[model samples]
Target: MKSILNRRNVALSGGPSRLLAVAHDAATQRTAAASDAAAHDPHAASASGSPADSVVEIESRAEPAAGATLPGEGASGPRPVSTLHAVPVMPAHLNGRPVQIADGAAFEALRAADELTTFRVYRCFAYTVSLFFHPPTLGYFVALHQESVLWRALKANDLDAAGSAFHLMQEQATRLADGETRRAQLVAQNAELARLIEESETQAERLRVDLQRHSEQEQTVTGRQHQVRKEVAQLEAQRIAAQAQLNKAHRALHQLKVATSEGVPHLHAR
Candidate 1:
Protein backbone atom coordinates (compact mmCIF):
# COMPACT_ATOMS: atom_id res chain seq x y z
CA MET A 1 0.00 0.00 0.00
CA LYS A 2 3.00 2.39 0.79
CA SER A 3 4.54 2.03 -2.72
CA ILE A 4 1.22 2.75 -4.51
CA LEU A 5 0.72 6.03 -2.53
CA ASN A 6 4.28 7.30 -3.46
CA ARG A 7 3.68 6.57 -7.19
CA ARG A 8 0.43 8.52 -7.27
CA ASN A 9 2.10 11.66 -5.62
CA VAL A 10 4.99 11.61 -8.11
CA ALA A 11 2.65 11.47 -11.14
CA LEU A 12 0.57 14.46 -9.92
CA SER A 13 3.69 16.61 -9.20
CA GLY A 14 5.22 15.78 -12.62
CA GLY A 15 2.06 16.76 -14.40
CA PRO A 16 1.92 20.19 -12.60
CA SER A 17 5.64 20.90 -13.55
CA ARG A 18 4.96 20.23 -17.28
CA LEU A 19 1.86 22.51 -17.28
CA LEU A 20 3.89 25.35 -15.60
CA ALA A 21 6.66 25.05 -18.27
CA VAL A 22 4.12 25.22 -21.14
CA ALA A 23 2.40 28.32 -19.61
CA HIS A 24 5.84 30.06 -19.23
CA ASP A 25 6.76 29.31 -22.92
CA ALA A 26 3.38 30.73 -24.17
CA ALA A 27 3.84 33.98 -22.10
CA THR A 28 7.35 34.47 -23.60
CA GLN A 29 5.99 34.06 -27.19
CA ARG A 30 3.21 36.67 -26.56
CA THR A 31 5.73 39.14 -25.09
CA ALA A 32 8.02 38.78 -28.16
CA ALA A 33 5.04 39.40 -30.58
CA ALA A 34 4.06 42.62 -28.72
CA SER A 35 7.68 43.88 -28.94
CA ASP A 36 7.74 43.20 -32.70
CA ALA A 37 4.44 45.12 -33.22
CA ALA A 38 5.74 48.12 -31.26
CA ALA A 39 8.93 48.19 -33.37
CA HIS A 40 6.94 48.12 -36.72
CA ASP A 41 4.37 50.79 -35.87
CA PRO A 42 5.86 54.31 -35.28
CA HIS A 43 2.68 55.47 -33.49
CA ALA A 44 3.02 52.72 -30.91
CA ALA A 45 4.57 53.56 -27.55
CA SER A 46 7.25 51.60 -25.72
CA ALA A 47 6.26 49.06 -23.05
CA SER A 48 7.46 51.52 -20.38
CA GLY A 49 5.34 54.55 -21.66
CA SER A 50 1.57 55.27 -21.77
CA PRO A 51 -0.57 56.50 -24.80
CA ALA A 52 -0.88 59.99 -23.18
CA ASP A 53 2.79 60.76 -23.94
CA SER A 54 2.19 60.18 -27.69
CA VAL A 55 -0.92 62.40 -27.57
CA VAL A 56 1.05 65.22 -26.04
CA GLU A 57 3.76 65.00 -28.79
CA ILE A 58 1.09 65.06 -31.57
CA GLU A 59 -0.61 68.10 -30.04
CA SER A 60 2.71 69.95 -29.73
CA ARG A 61 3.52 69.40 -33.45
CA ALA A 62 0.02 70.44 -34.69
CA GLU A 63 -0.36 73.47 -32.43
CA PRO A 64 2.75 75.38 -33.67
CA ALA A 65 1.33 78.74 -32.31
CA ALA A 66 2.41 77.69 -28.82
CA GLY A 67 5.51 79.99 -28.56
CA ALA A 68 7.09 78.62 -31.78
CA THR A 69 8.59 80.80 -34.57
CA LEU A 70 8.30 79.82 -38.29
CA PRO A 71 11.01 80.24 -40.92
CA GLY A 72 11.60 83.83 -42.32
CA GLU A 73 8.76 85.43 -40.37
CA GLY A 74 9.11 88.51 -38.08
CA ALA A 75 7.04 90.91 -35.97
CA SER A 76 5.80 94.26 -37.22
CA GLY A 77 8.16 97.30 -37.51
CA PRO A 78 7.93 101.00 -38.59
CA ARG A 79 7.68 102.31 -42.24
CA PRO A 80 7.60 105.76 -43.94
CA VAL A 81 4.92 107.56 -46.02
CA SER A 82 4.83 110.82 -47.98
CA THR A 83 3.07 113.97 -46.67
CA LEU A 84 4.25 116.75 -49.08
CA HIS A 85 1.69 118.62 -51.20
CA ALA A 86 2.01 118.96 -55.01
CA VAL A 87 2.13 122.25 -56.93
CA PRO A 88 -0.31 123.34 -59.66
CA VAL A 89 0.67 124.32 -63.23
CA MET A 90 -0.54 127.24 -65.34
CA PRO A 91 -1.45 127.34 -69.09
CA ALA A 92 -0.26 129.61 -71.94
CA HIS A 93 -1.61 130.77 -75.30
CA LEU A 94 -0.13 130.31 -78.82
CA ASN A 95 -1.32 132.51 -81.69
CA GLY A 96 -5.07 132.53 -81.18
CA ARG A 97 -5.07 128.98 -79.93
CA PRO A 98 -5.08 128.20 -76.21
CA VAL A 99 -2.62 125.53 -75.20
CA GLN A 100 -0.42 124.40 -72.29
CA ILE A 101 3.07 125.90 -72.40
CA ALA A 102 4.80 122.87 -70.92
CA ASP A 103 7.37 122.02 -73.59
CA GLY A 104 10.31 124.10 -74.92
CA ALA A 105 8.69 125.39 -78.11
CA ALA A 106 5.54 126.60 -76.41
CA PHE A 107 7.41 128.27 -73.54
CA GLU A 108 9.84 129.94 -75.94
CA ALA A 109 7.02 131.32 -78.04
CA LEU A 110 5.18 132.72 -75.03
CA ARG A 111 8.28 134.28 -73.51
CA ALA A 112 9.42 135.79 -76.81
CA ALA A 113 6.06 137.39 -77.47
CA ASP A 114 5.87 138.91 -74.01
CA GLU A 115 9.39 140.31 -74.25
CA LEU A 116 8.79 141.62 -77.76
CA THR A 117 5.66 143.46 -76.72
CA THR A 118 7.50 145.16 -73.88
CA PHE A 119 10.35 146.17 -76.18
CA ARG A 120 7.93 147.52 -78.73
CA VAL A 121 6.27 149.80 -76.19
CA TYR A 122 9.63 151.06 -75.00
CA ARG A 123 10.75 151.75 -78.58
CA CYS A 124 7.58 153.66 -79.33
CA PHE A 125 8.16 155.88 -76.33
CA ALA A 126 11.72 156.57 -77.47
CA TYR A 127 10.53 157.45 -80.95
CA THR A 128 7.94 159.85 -79.58
CA VAL A 129 10.55 161.63 -77.51
CA SER A 130 12.87 161.86 -80.49
CA LEU A 131 10.14 163.31 -82.65
CA PHE A 132 9.22 166.00 -80.14
CA PHE A 133 12.68 167.13 -78.95
CA HIS A 134 14.51 167.02 -82.29
CA PRO A 135 12.68 167.57 -85.55
CA PRO A 136 15.84 166.79 -87.57
CA THR A 137 15.84 163.42 -85.80
CA LEU A 138 12.79 162.33 -87.82
CA GLY A 139 15.00 159.85 -89.60
CA TYR A 140 15.79 158.11 -86.31
CA PHE A 141 12.13 158.07 -85.34
CA VAL A 142 11.16 156.52 -88.65
CA ALA A 143 13.85 153.91 -88.24
CA LEU A 144 12.63 153.10 -84.75
CA HIS A 145 9.07 152.84 -86.02
CA GLN A 146 10.16 150.50 -88.75
CA GLU A 147 12.10 148.41 -86.24
CA SER A 148 9.03 148.30 -84.03
CA VAL A 149 7.07 146.94 -86.97
CA LEU A 150 9.72 144.34 -87.60
CA TRP A 151 9.77 143.23 -83.95
CA ARG A 152 5.99 143.14 -83.95
CA ALA A 153 6.08 140.88 -86.96
CA LEU A 154 8.78 138.80 -85.30
CA LYS A 155 6.64 138.60 -82.21
CA ALA A 156 3.98 137.18 -84.47
CA ASN A 157 6.71 135.00 -85.99
CA ASP A 158 6.37 136.50 -89.47
CA LEU A 159 9.81 136.43 -91.10
CA ASP A 160 8.67 137.80 -94.45
CA ALA A 161 7.18 141.02 -93.07
CA ALA A 162 10.16 141.67 -90.85
CA GLY A 163 12.60 141.31 -93.77
CA SER A 164 10.59 143.63 -96.01
CA ALA A 165 10.29 146.27 -93.30
CA PHE A 166 14.01 146.10 -92.54
CA HIS A 167 14.83 146.72 -96.20
CA LEU A 168 12.47 149.67 -96.37
CA MET A 169 13.90 151.22 -93.23
CA GLN A 170 17.44 150.91 -94.58
CA GLU A 171 16.42 152.69 -97.76
CA GLN A 172 14.86 155.51 -95.73
CA ALA A 173 18.03 156.01 -93.70
CA THR A 174 20.08 156.15 -96.87
CA ARG A 175 17.80 158.78 -98.37
CA LEU A 176 17.89 160.91 -95.22
CA ALA A 177 21.69 160.89 -95.16
CA ASP A 178 21.83 161.79 -98.82
CA GLY A 179 19.45 164.73 -98.39
CA GLU A 180 21.48 166.17 -95.50
CA THR A 181 24.69 165.88 -97.52
CA ARG A 182 23.15 167.63 -100.53
CA ARG A 183 21.74 170.45 -98.37
CA ALA A 184 25.20 171.04 -96.85
CA GLN A 185 26.76 171.19 -100.31
CA LEU A 186 24.16 173.72 -101.44
CA VAL A 187 24.85 175.95 -98.46
CA ALA A 188 28.58 175.91 -99.26
CA GLN A 189 27.80 176.86 -102.87
CA ASN A 190 25.62 179.77 -101.74
CA ALA A 191 28.48 181.12 -99.60
CA GLU A 192 30.83 180.86 -102.56
CA LEU A 193 28.40 182.79 -104.74
CA ALA A 194 28.17 185.61 -102.17
CA ARG A 195 31.96 185.85 -102.01
CA LEU A 196 32.16 186.01 -105.80
CA ILE A 197 29.62 188.86 -105.91
CA GLU A 198 31.69 190.85 -103.40
CA GLU A 199 34.89 190.28 -105.41
CA SER A 200 33.20 191.39 -108.66
CA GLU A 201 31.99 194.62 -107.01
CA THR A 202 35.52 195.41 -105.79
CA GLN A 203 36.99 194.73 -109.29
CA ALA A 204 34.41 197.03 -110.91
CA GLU A 205 35.25 199.87 -108.51
CA ARG A 206 38.97 199.48 -109.21
CA LEU A 207 38.41 199.55 -113.00
CA ARG A 208 36.31 202.72 -112.75
CA VAL A 209 39.02 204.48 -110.73
CA ASP A 210 41.71 203.40 -113.24
CA LEU A 211 39.64 204.65 -116.20
CA GLN A 212 39.18 208.06 -114.52
CA ARG A 213 42.91 208.38 -113.77
CA HIS A 214 43.76 207.35 -117.40
CA SER A 215 41.38 209.95 -118.84
CA GLU A 216 43.14 212.64 -116.68
CA GLN A 217 46.57 211.40 -117.90
CA GLU A 218 46.45 210.41 -121.62
CA GLN A 219 50.19 209.66 -121.77
CA THR A 220 49.75 206.59 -119.38
CA VAL A 221 46.19 205.73 -120.52
CA THR A 222 47.31 202.74 -122.70
CA GLY A 223 49.17 201.04 -119.77
CA ARG A 224 46.25 201.78 -117.39
CA GLN A 225 43.74 200.13 -119.87
CA HIS A 226 45.95 197.04 -120.16
CA GLN A 227 46.18 196.71 -116.38
CA VAL A 228 42.41 197.18 -115.98
CA ARG A 229 41.70 194.51 -118.69
CA LYS A 230 43.97 192.06 -116.85
CA GLU A 231 42.16 192.69 -113.54
CA VAL A 232 38.72 192.26 -115.23
CA ALA A 233 39.79 188.97 -116.80
CA GLN A 234 40.85 187.51 -113.40
CA LEU A 235 37.57 188.61 -111.79
CA GLU A 236 35.57 186.99 -114.70
CA ALA A 237 37.45 183.71 -114.26
CA GLN A 238 36.72 183.63 -110.54
CA ARG A 239 33.03 184.33 -111.18
CA ILE A 240 32.86 181.45 -113.73
CA ALA A 241 34.43 179.03 -111.26
CA ALA A 242 31.97 180.02 -108.57
CA GLN A 243 29.00 179.60 -111.00
CA ALA A 244 30.24 176.16 -111.99
CA GLN A 245 30.43 175.04 -108.34
CA LEU A 246 26.91 176.36 -107.77
CA ASN A 247 25.54 174.47 -110.81
CA LYS A 248 27.13 171.21 -109.68
CA ALA A 249 25.64 171.60 -106.22
CA HIS A 250 22.20 172.27 -107.69
CA ARG A 251 22.39 169.10 -109.81
CA ALA A 252 23.34 167.01 -106.80
CA LEU A 253 20.50 168.50 -104.80
CA HIS A 254 17.98 167.70 -107.54
CA GLN A 255 19.10 164.12 -107.80
CA LEU A 256 18.90 163.68 -104.03
CA LYS A 257 15.40 165.12 -103.98
CA VAL A 258 14.29 162.64 -106.60
CA ALA A 259 15.81 159.71 -104.70
CA THR A 260 14.36 160.88 -101.43
CA SER A 261 10.92 161.22 -102.99
CA GLU A 262 11.01 157.64 -104.24
CA GLY A 263 12.79 156.03 -101.27
CA VAL A 264 11.22 157.60 -98.17
CA PRO A 265 8.18 159.75 -98.73
CA HIS A 266 7.39 160.24 -95.03
CA LEU A 267 10.69 161.79 -93.98
CA HIS A 268 11.11 163.70 -97.23
CA ALA A 269 7.64 165.21 -96.91
CA ARG A 270 8.26 166.05 -93.25
Candidate 2:
Protein backbone atom coordinates (compact mmCIF):
# COMPACT_ATOMS: atom_id res chain seq x y z
CA MET A 1 0.00 0.00 0.00
CA LYS A 2 2.83 2.43 0.78
CA SER A 3 4.50 1.55 -2.51
CA ILE A 4 1.24 2.12 -4.41
CA LEU A 5 0.78 5.46 -2.65
CA ASN A 6 4.34 6.48 -3.46
CA ARG A 7 3.91 5.56 -7.15
CA ARG A 8 0.59 7.39 -7.39
CA ASN A 9 2.12 10.44 -5.73
CA VAL A 10 4.81 10.47 -8.40
CA ALA A 11 2.17 10.60 -11.19
CA LEU A 12 2.36 13.69 -13.40
CA SER A 13 -1.38 14.41 -13.64
CA GLY A 14 -3.18 13.32 -10.47
CA GLY A 15 -1.96 15.18 -7.39
CA PRO A 16 -0.91 13.74 -4.00
CA SER A 17 -4.41 13.80 -2.49
CA ARG A 18 -5.60 11.23 -5.02
CA LEU A 19 -2.68 9.03 -4.08
CA LEU A 20 -3.63 9.28 -0.38
CA ALA A 21 -7.24 8.21 -1.09
CA VAL A 22 -6.05 5.26 -3.16
CA ALA A 23 -3.61 4.27 -0.41
CA HIS A 24 -6.37 4.41 2.25
CA ASP A 25 -8.73 2.23 0.23
CA ALA A 26 -6.00 -0.28 -0.52
CA ALA A 27 -5.02 -0.43 3.17
CA THR A 28 -8.60 -1.03 4.26
CA GLN A 29 -9.13 -3.83 1.81
CA ARG A 30 -5.85 -5.52 2.84
CA THR A 31 -6.72 -5.16 6.55
CA ALA A 32 -10.17 -6.63 6.03
CA ALA A 33 -8.70 -9.59 4.12
CA ALA A 34 -6.10 -10.16 6.81
CA SER A 35 -8.73 -10.03 9.52
CA ASP A 36 -10.84 -12.61 7.69
CA ALA A 37 -7.88 -14.92 7.23
CA ALA A 38 -6.92 -14.54 10.90
CA ALA A 39 -10.45 -15.23 12.07
CA HIS A 40 -10.57 -18.46 10.04
CA ASP A 41 -7.20 -19.66 11.34
CA PRO A 42 -7.50 -19.89 15.12
CA HIS A 43 -3.73 -19.49 15.66
CA ALA A 44 -3.17 -16.94 12.89
CA ALA A 45 -3.49 -13.95 15.21
CA SER A 46 -0.94 -15.49 17.58
CA ALA A 47 1.35 -16.24 14.65
CA SER A 48 1.14 -12.66 13.37
CA GLY A 49 1.63 -11.21 16.86
CA SER A 50 -0.63 -8.15 16.40
CA PRO A 51 -3.08 -6.51 13.93
CA ALA A 52 -0.63 -3.66 13.18
CA ASP A 53 2.20 -6.19 12.48
CA SER A 54 -0.08 -8.16 10.13
CA VAL A 55 -1.00 -5.03 8.23
CA VAL A 56 2.69 -4.09 7.88
CA GLU A 57 3.53 -7.54 6.49
CA ILE A 58 0.61 -7.45 4.01
CA GLU A 59 1.69 -3.98 2.76
CA SER A 60 5.26 -5.18 2.29
CA ARG A 61 4.04 -8.17 0.27
CA ALA A 62 1.75 -5.93 -1.83
CA GLU A 63 4.73 -3.77 -2.87
CA PRO A 64 5.68 -6.09 -5.80
CA ALA A 65 2.12 -6.09 -7.15
CA ALA A 66 2.03 -2.30 -6.86
CA GLY A 67 5.28 -2.02 -8.82
CA ALA A 68 3.86 -3.89 -11.84
CA THR A 69 3.14 -1.50 -14.77
CA LEU A 70 -0.38 -0.80 -16.06
CA PRO A 71 -1.26 -0.79 -19.74
CA GLY A 72 0.58 1.99 -21.71
CA GLU A 73 3.04 2.53 -18.80
CA GLY A 74 6.65 1.49 -18.78
CA ALA A 75 8.05 -1.34 -16.63
CA SER A 76 9.59 1.15 -14.23
CA GLY A 77 9.60 4.91 -13.56
CA PRO A 78 6.87 7.38 -14.66
CA ARG A 79 4.06 6.56 -17.06
CA PRO A 80 4.66 7.31 -20.75
CA VAL A 81 3.46 10.60 -22.12
CA SER A 82 0.65 10.25 -24.67
CA THR A 83 -1.73 12.47 -26.65
CA LEU A 84 -5.49 12.38 -25.99
CA HIS A 85 -7.83 11.19 -28.75
CA ALA A 86 -11.44 12.35 -28.64
CA VAL A 87 -14.00 9.63 -29.11
CA PRO A 88 -16.81 10.70 -31.46
CA VAL A 89 -19.98 10.44 -29.37
CA MET A 90 -22.11 12.71 -31.55
CA PRO A 91 -24.10 11.32 -34.44
CA ALA A 92 -22.92 12.03 -37.98
CA HIS A 93 -26.15 13.81 -38.86
CA LEU A 94 -29.12 15.22 -37.01
CA ASN A 95 -32.34 15.97 -38.97
CA GLY A 96 -30.44 15.87 -42.26
CA ARG A 97 -27.98 18.55 -41.05
CA PRO A 98 -24.37 18.24 -40.01
CA VAL A 99 -24.08 18.06 -36.23
CA GLN A 100 -22.33 20.71 -34.19
CA ILE A 101 -19.39 19.76 -31.98
CA ALA A 102 -20.71 19.84 -28.40
CA ASP A 103 -18.78 16.83 -27.15
CA GLY A 104 -15.94 17.76 -24.82
CA ALA A 105 -13.42 15.54 -26.58
CA ALA A 106 -14.45 16.66 -30.06
CA PHE A 107 -14.22 20.31 -29.10
CA GLU A 108 -10.76 19.87 -27.64
CA ALA A 109 -9.62 17.92 -30.67
CA LEU A 110 -10.87 20.68 -32.96
CA ARG A 111 -8.88 23.24 -31.00
CA ALA A 112 -5.66 21.22 -31.34
CA ALA A 113 -6.21 20.51 -35.02
CA ASP A 114 -4.19 22.23 -37.73
CA GLU A 115 -6.07 24.12 -40.37
CA LEU A 116 -6.23 22.88 -43.98
CA THR A 117 -7.68 26.20 -45.09
CA THR A 118 -8.57 29.45 -43.36
CA PHE A 119 -10.34 32.73 -44.15
CA ARG A 120 -10.12 36.00 -42.26
CA VAL A 121 -12.71 38.76 -42.33
CA TYR A 122 -13.76 42.03 -40.61
CA ARG A 123 -10.82 44.10 -41.93
CA CYS A 124 -9.38 45.70 -38.79
CA PHE A 125 -11.12 43.29 -36.47
CA ALA A 126 -9.65 39.85 -36.74
CA TYR A 127 -12.34 37.19 -37.02
CA THR A 128 -11.53 33.87 -38.61
CA VAL A 129 -13.02 30.51 -39.66
CA SER A 130 -11.03 27.46 -40.63
CA LEU A 131 -11.46 24.03 -42.20
CA PHE A 132 -9.54 21.00 -41.06
CA PHE A 133 -9.51 17.34 -42.10
CA HIS A 134 -8.60 15.08 -39.23
CA PRO A 135 -6.73 12.14 -40.78
CA PRO A 136 -7.26 9.85 -37.82
CA THR A 137 -11.03 10.04 -37.88
CA LEU A 138 -11.32 10.73 -41.62
CA GLY A 139 -13.75 13.58 -40.92
CA TYR A 140 -13.88 17.32 -41.54
CA PHE A 141 -14.00 19.99 -38.83
CA VAL A 142 -14.87 23.65 -39.22
CA ALA A 143 -14.49 26.26 -36.53
CA LEU A 144 -15.29 29.90 -35.89
CA HIS A 145 -12.37 31.49 -34.14
CA GLN A 146 -11.09 34.78 -32.70
CA GLU A 147 -7.58 35.14 -31.41
CA SER A 148 -6.59 31.70 -30.03
CA VAL A 149 -10.00 30.52 -28.91
CA LEU A 150 -12.64 28.73 -30.92
CA TRP A 151 -16.20 29.98 -30.41
CA ARG A 152 -17.99 27.14 -32.17
CA ALA A 153 -17.28 24.10 -34.31
CA LEU A 154 -18.94 21.56 -36.59
CA LYS A 155 -18.01 18.00 -37.48
CA ALA A 156 -18.81 16.05 -40.68
CA ASN A 157 -17.89 12.59 -41.82
CA ASP A 158 -18.44 12.92 -45.58
CA LEU A 159 -17.78 15.54 -48.27
CA ASP A 160 -21.46 16.51 -48.61
CA ALA A 161 -21.84 17.19 -44.89
CA ALA A 162 -18.46 18.90 -44.82
CA GLY A 163 -19.48 21.18 -47.67
CA SER A 164 -22.70 22.12 -45.94
CA ALA A 165 -20.85 22.96 -42.71
CA PHE A 166 -18.22 24.94 -44.57
CA HIS A 167 -20.84 26.96 -46.40
CA LEU A 168 -22.71 27.64 -43.17
CA MET A 169 -19.58 28.98 -41.50
CA GLN A 170 -18.71 30.96 -44.62
CA GLU A 171 -22.13 32.59 -44.67
CA GLN A 172 -21.75 33.73 -41.07
CA ALA A 173 -18.30 35.13 -41.74
CA THR A 174 -19.51 36.96 -44.84
CA ARG A 175 -22.35 38.60 -42.96
CA LEU A 176 -19.94 39.89 -40.33
CA ALA A 177 -17.56 41.07 -43.02
CA ASP A 178 -20.33 43.00 -44.71
CA GLY A 179 -20.92 45.04 -41.56
CA GLU A 180 -17.22 45.64 -41.10
CA THR A 181 -16.83 46.79 -44.68
CA ARG A 182 -19.60 49.32 -44.21
CA ARG A 183 -18.06 50.60 -41.02
CA ALA A 184 -14.69 51.00 -42.75
CA GLN A 185 -16.27 52.85 -45.61
CA LEU A 186 -18.12 55.17 -43.24
CA VAL A 187 -14.89 56.01 -41.43
CA ALA A 188 -13.09 56.74 -44.66
CA GLN A 189 -15.92 58.97 -45.86
CA ASN A 190 -15.93 60.88 -42.57
CA ALA A 191 -12.21 61.51 -42.80
CA GLU A 192 -12.55 62.78 -46.35
CA LEU A 193 -15.38 65.13 -45.41
CA ALA A 194 -13.35 66.55 -42.56
CA ARG A 195 -10.46 67.24 -44.94
CA LEU A 196 -12.73 69.00 -47.41
CA ILE A 197 -14.23 71.14 -44.67
CA GLU A 198 -10.77 72.18 -43.51
CA GLU A 199 -9.72 73.14 -47.01
CA SER A 200 -12.86 75.20 -47.53
CA GLU A 201 -12.32 77.03 -44.24
CA THR A 202 -8.71 77.76 -45.19
CA GLN A 203 -9.77 79.13 -48.56
CA ALA A 204 -12.41 81.30 -46.93
CA GLU A 205 -9.80 82.74 -44.56
CA ARG A 206 -7.50 83.59 -47.48
CA LEU A 207 -10.35 85.32 -49.33
CA ARG A 208 -11.18 87.32 -46.20
CA VAL A 209 -7.55 88.49 -45.97
CA ASP A 210 -7.57 89.50 -49.65
CA LEU A 211 -10.79 91.43 -49.20
CA GLN A 212 -9.34 93.30 -46.19
CA ARG A 213 -6.22 94.24 -48.17
CA HIS A 214 -8.37 95.52 -51.04
CA SER A 215 -10.44 97.61 -48.62
CA GLU A 216 -7.29 99.19 -47.18
CA GLN A 217 -6.16 100.11 -50.69
CA GLU A 218 -9.56 101.69 -51.39
CA GLN A 219 -9.32 103.74 -48.22
CA THR A 220 -5.80 104.93 -49.15
CA VAL A 221 -7.04 105.94 -52.64
CA THR A 222 -9.99 107.85 -51.15
CA GLY A 223 -7.63 109.80 -48.82
CA ARG A 224 -5.35 110.68 -51.80
CA GLN A 225 -8.35 111.80 -53.90
CA HIS A 226 -9.46 114.17 -51.12
CA GLN A 227 -6.00 115.81 -51.06
CA VAL A 228 -6.02 116.15 -54.87
CA ARG A 229 -9.45 117.88 -54.81
CA LYS A 230 -8.20 120.44 -52.27
CA GLU A 231 -5.12 121.21 -54.43
CA VAL A 232 -7.33 121.64 -57.57
CA ALA A 233 -9.61 124.16 -55.81
CA GLN A 234 -6.64 126.29 -54.59
CA LEU A 235 -5.07 126.34 -58.07
CA GLU A 236 -8.34 127.43 -59.65
CA ALA A 237 -8.63 130.43 -57.29
CA GLN A 238 -5.01 131.55 -57.97
CA ARG A 239 -5.52 131.34 -61.78
CA ILE A 240 -8.62 133.58 -61.63
CA ALA A 241 -6.79 136.27 -59.61
CA ALA A 242 -3.79 136.29 -61.99
CA GLN A 243 -6.07 136.59 -65.09
CA ALA A 244 -7.91 139.64 -63.64
CA GLN A 245 -4.64 141.51 -62.86
CA LEU A 246 -3.33 140.95 -66.45
CA ASN A 247 -6.63 142.21 -68.01
CA LYS A 248 -6.51 145.42 -65.87
CA ALA A 249 -2.87 146.11 -66.94
CA HIS A 250 -3.82 145.70 -70.61
CA ARG A 251 -6.73 148.18 -70.34
CA ALA A 252 -4.52 150.77 -68.63
CA LEU A 253 -1.89 150.56 -71.45
CA HIS A 254 -4.61 151.07 -74.11
CA GLN A 255 -5.90 154.21 -72.43
CA LEU A 256 -2.40 155.72 -72.24
CA LYS A 257 -1.89 155.05 -75.98
CA VAL A 258 -5.24 156.77 -76.76
CA ALA A 259 -4.21 159.99 -74.88
CA THR A 260 -0.85 160.16 -76.67
CA SER A 261 -2.59 159.75 -80.01
CA GLU A 262 -4.99 162.60 -79.07
CA GLY A 263 -1.99 164.85 -78.26
CA VAL A 264 -0.26 164.12 -81.61
CA PRO A 265 -3.32 163.93 -83.91
CA HIS A 266 -3.23 167.44 -85.57
CA LEU A 267 -0.41 166.79 -88.02
CA HIS A 268 -1.86 163.60 -89.56
CA ALA A 269 -5.41 165.04 -89.65
CA ARG A 270 -4.21 168.06 -91.60
- For residues 1-270, could you state the per-residue lDDT of candidate 2 as single tens digits? 466645654543333223434554766876787788787995886676666664566556545445545444344547567999998784657448666574545666555565233332222245576666666667766777656566777777766676677677777877867878799999999999999999999999999999999999999999999999999999888889988988998999999989889877466655
**What TM-score, over all chains together, does every model reach?**
0.22, 0.45
Residue-by-residue lDDT tens digits, candidate 1, 1-270 = 243234334434442122233333444555566567777974563654544444344333333232233232333423347798987763333334232212334334444554222222222221210111112211111123333332212111233333344444445545545666687789999999999999999999999999887777885777788989999999999999999999999999999999888976465554
lDDT of each: 0.46, 0.67
Q: Model 2: which ten-residue window has the lowest total lDDT?
A: 115-124
User: Relative to the unseen true structure, what is the C-alpha lDDT of residue 227 in candidate 1, on a scale of 0 to 100?
Assistant: 89
Model 1 regions lying over 4 Å from their true place: 1-167, 177-179, 219-270
Candidate 2 accuracy as lDDT? 0.67
**Candidate 1: worst-modelled 10 consecutive residues by lDDT:** 126-135
Candidate 2: stretches off by over 4 Å: 1-124, 134-138, 174-185, 238-270
